[model samples]
Each structure stands twice: as structure tokens, then as C-alpha cells.
Target: MKFRKATSENVQAIVEMIADDPLGSKRENYTIPLPKTYYDAFERIDADPNQELIVVENDIGQVIAVFQMTFIPYLTYQGGIRAQIEGVRVHKDHRGLGIGKTIFHWAIQRAKERNAHVLQLTTDKKRPDAIRFYESLGFNASHEGMKMHF
Candidate 1:
């Protein structure tokens, strides 16, 4: 599999994968066209130098996975940068094939290249399996993450 930056065209596939899950089905309305918010976010991500919205594709060139990794500069950790990853998803057909591990491994190396002192991500408390998957790859639950949706 190969990884590449997600272009405007890949957004639909990415959202579809996200919606395939029970939790996402209620959130993503795929019965019709995707909402404009997704497009807006895509445009914003494309403009941000620190944000990397990436997609993974198979040898056949089919987009199968998606994630966004952001490199945030900060004064913490002796001024070292931090790499934050989110929206990680693998297509149902591609699950259980080590693609998630490959994505994480690549993100770690990318973080190191950018001089990130730490690589971080937050998974929903409901996703115990995902948390365990992350732990298997050396991520720790060092902090509690909270968010307020608009």
C-alpha cells in the first residue's frame, strides 16, 4: 500500500469509511451528498502547512485508508514540536491487514523527522479495541482529552 495526501476527490471515500461505523452512521448523512462542512475543512487543511490529510491506497490505486496528522509547534517539551493524529480509518475490506500499524509507523517516522517530542492521538472511550490497538503500537493514555462540539 502507498500513502499520499488526500486530494479533493478522496474526501467522499474517506467520509464513507467513517460513516460505515455504527457511531459514524448517525453523524455522517451519506443518504445524499456530503455536507459542505467537509469540503470547507478540506480546503482549510490544504491551506495549513502543519496539517497533513493523508490517504492510503492499495497497489491497484484504490483509496482505502485515511488519517490526518498535524505538526504543532509549542514551547512545551523543551520547545519540541508535537505530532497529533486524528480521523484514522481503514476501509472495511482492508481491516485486519496491518494497514493501521503501517499508518502509525509512518506517522511516528514523520513526527521524528519534524522533531516532534511526542506523537499523540485521542480515541473515544467507547472504542476499547482501538485504544488497545494504539497501545500495541506504543501510544500511552497519558492525558484525558475533552472536547465541546459546536
Candidate 2:
């Protein structure tokens, strides 16, 4: 498998894998010739030095997993940088092949390379399986995450 920053060609596959999940199915419009908004967002992320949209490809060069990482400069923690992981997804066919763990290992190493003091992510409480998988990767439920939909 290969991991790399995503390109325009990867946006569709990434959205498809994201929408395959329960919550993303409600929020993402995954379609042939996806909405321009998706491409626009990708462009913005691509231009930002602190943002990384990553994809994992199989041996034959098919995108099978994806995640977005953002590095934020914080005034707290001694003016440190925090890495946030989001939108992680693995194609349903490749779920049990340890791709998730491998992808996370890559993310963690990337965070360390960026000199981030901490790496954090929030998963919807409804996704118990996701929470368990994250815990297996050494994440702890140390804080209660709350959000208000706009």
C-alpha cells in the first residue's frame, strides 16, 4: 500500500468511502461529477500549508482509504502545534486488512514530523465501533466532545 497527499483525481474515491459510513451518508453528496463544493473545498485545503488531505492506495493503485489532518497553532501548551485527524475512512472491502491501523501510524508519524505537541480527533458518539478502533490505537476518551450543528 502507498500513502500520499491526495490529488484532484482522489477526491471522488475519498468522498465515496466517506459517504459509505452512516453519518457521512447523511452529510456528503457522493455522486458522479460531485458537487463543485467538494472540489472547491479540496482546493482550499490543498493550498493551505497546515492542512493535509491524504489517501491510501493499494498495490494495483486504487484508492482504498483516506483521512484529513490539520495542524493548528495554539497559544496554550507553550505556543505549540496540535494535529487534528478527521474524516478517516477505509473502503468496506478493505476494512479488516489492518489498513486503518497502518494509516493511523502514518498519520502519527506525520504529526511527529510536524512537531505537534498532541494529536486529537473526535468521532461521533453513535459510532461505537469507531470509538473502539480508535482506542485500540492508543487514544483515550479523556474529554467530552460536544458540538452544535449549524
After the best TM-score superposition of candidate 1, give how far the Cα of residue 67 lies from its true spot, in angstroms.
0.4
Q: How many backbone clashes does candidate 2 have?
A: 0
Q: How many residue pairs clash (N, CA or C atoms closer than 3 angstroms) in each of the candidate models, in the order given? A: 0, 0
Candidate 2 regions with alpha-carbon error over 4 angstroms:
none
lDDT score, candidate 1: 0.92
Clashing pairs in 2: none
Worst 10 residues of 1 by lDDT: 25-34
What TM-score does structure 1 among the candidates reach?
Answer: 0.94
Q: Report lDDT (CA) for all predictions.
A: 0.92, 0.94
How does model 2 fare in lDDT?
A: 0.94
* Models, CA RMSD each: 1.2, 0.8
